[model samples]
Each structure stands twice: as structure tokens, then as C-alpha cells.
Target: MQLTTFFFVCITNASSTQFWPGFKILLVTVVVLLAVKNYKFLVLVSHALFLMIP
Candidate 1:
């Protein structure tokens, strides 16, 4: 699940012309949250990634 979130953020960042750095921060945040079993954070990031993607 964490890996999925990381990939989602990475892809979203790669696709965008700007706001990619924010994705990096989001990726890191997701990783930390995954370590702590914060599934809510994962869900939030996933939705954010979905919104960012085309």
C-alpha cells in the first residue's frame, strides 16, 4: 500500500509542469505515515494524486 502511494505521487509529480516538489514532500509524508500505519494519510495522498493526474 505504501509503495502504491509512493508510485502515485511520483507519477503525479512527473506528469505536472509545476508542483512536483510538493509531490516529493507528499511522498515522504506518505512513507512516514505508512510506517506508522496511518491508512487515512495514504487515502488522502492517493486522492490528491488522483486529482493531480490527468
Candidate 2:
């Protein structure tokens, strides 16, 4: 929920040319934080998300 809002804000604030690079950095930071805080939860969440993909 918060991540989605963060991503949306990041997108709306960034210029199109800068969006991808900025988003990549944001994603890496988030992944690292989640990894450090709870690797198990990250794994489960990622697994569930992956299953949702077509």
C-alpha cells in the first residue's frame, strides 16, 4: 500500500526521461531494506506475486 503510493508519487514527480532510472534505484533500496528486515517475508511475498503473474 505504502510502496504503491511511493511509486506513484515518484512517477508523478519525475520527468519521463528520469523515471526508469529513479524507479530502479527506489526498487533496489526497497529490496535491500526488506531483505535486511525480513528475508522470509520478502520471499513469501515475492512468491505470491510471482504466482499472480500470467
Candidate 2: misplaced stretches above 4 Å?
1-19, 41-54
lDDT of 1 by residue, 1-54 (tens): 666666666656555756558766766575556646766765765676566657
lDDT of 2 by residue, 32-53 (tens): 5764676564654465444434
Error of 1 at 36 (Å): 6.4
Candidate maximizing lDDT: 1
Steric overlap count per candidate: 0, 0
- In angstroms, the error of model 2 at 25 is 0.7
- Please give the CA lDDT of all the candidate structures: 0.62, 0.52
**How high is each candidate's TM-score?**
0.37, 0.37
Worst 10 residues of 2 by lDDT: 8-17
Residue 7 in candidate 2, Cα distance off native in Å? 11
> Model 1: C-alpha RMSD to truth?
7.9
Tell me the lDDT of candidate 2.
0.52
Clashing pairs in 2: none
